[model samples]
Target: MSGPKEPLTRESLEPVPIQVFDDHMVLRPPNRLKERSAKRARTDDGGDRTVISRAENALKLLSQEFDAWMTKELDRLEEARRTLASAPSDAAADRFYRSAHDLRGQAATFGFPIAGLIADGLCIVLERKSEISDPTPLIDFHVESIRAVVRQNVREPDDSIGLALVDRLAVMRERALPA
Candidate 1:
């Protein structure tokens, strides 16, 4: 058994050119871990399927999961709406904020990217007006816009209708702003 080898002399070393990447540049490298834990993220049990096929399957599965998540978020949105309607209070605002916050974070992941964008705007409005005073119309409008996005099944962020909804929400915020 060898204990240790002698260190290589400076003369034995060779200079190699190095490439510098910009801070914003990301480089993906090949995974050297177990086959199951590869970048493609396959099951531990080896499959006859090729990497490409596995990637396609993953996309299909992701769509299914996205639909499920969307459904759950919609339900939460409904519950929040009902709470705000039945009793317009800080607690109601808090409940709605929680649901809106979740949508703001995950809407894009579930297919409705615009919903997340609009939800963020709505959250800001709610944050400022913590207490639902006389003007509940703004709150209703923001909530309706979000519900419309879900009901219409808007997935693309650039859709004309989605853009309009976002615009209206922004205008409502503008109206709320004191001169």
Candidate 2:
């Protein structure tokens, strides 16, 4: 009875149709107007789009230089730490100070603001050594900061990460340095 309770099928469950526009049936983005505009800006060779090519080359050079500088600075920091750990002499402290100073200069030159700040902190701490009562704390702090610099660079491709670490180092340096 009542059409056998009307079997519920997919066709019966379907909703009403919605209308959508289809003006230009062209495929692949219809490069009509913009393609002509692009053609006007080309050279005879039509290979390197001048402004874009220059910017790309500059970026490549910067990336290469940044990688090279980072490697050298990391090596310098390692050498400084090793020297400090090996002996109890002013010479080791001096080496650490020089390395920190050089690193700061180079980092600044490379636009790595954070690395520069960290280098400044390390330099200030190392410079205060004149027969330190306990050099271990200072040495440990430098080691940690150096490790942070290396880690930050590895984690983030941007040099600004160095700035964040340096900001932290600045706070630590202020609290740790003697009057």
**Regions of model 2 farther than 4 Å from truth:** 1-63, 154-167
Clashing pairs in 2: 114-162, 114-163
Per-residue lDDT of model 1, residues 1-179, tens digit only: 97557564432254434455875545443333344344554587466567578997887788888878887886887788788888878887788889989999998878899889888987877677744454567867777777788889988889998998898788878778553
Give the per-residue lDDT of model 2 (tens digit) for 13-51.
Answer: 445444555863333434444644566443566466776
- Give the candidate number with the greatest TM-score: 1
Root-mean-square deviation per candidate: 11.3, 21.9
Maximum-lDDT candidate: 1
Prediction 1 global C-alpha lDDT: 0.77
The regions of model 1 sitting more than 4 angstroms off are: 1-60, 88-91, 130-133
Summing lDDT over every window of 10 consecutive residues in candidate 2, give the lowest-scoring window. 24-33
Residue 101 error for model 2, in Å?
0.6
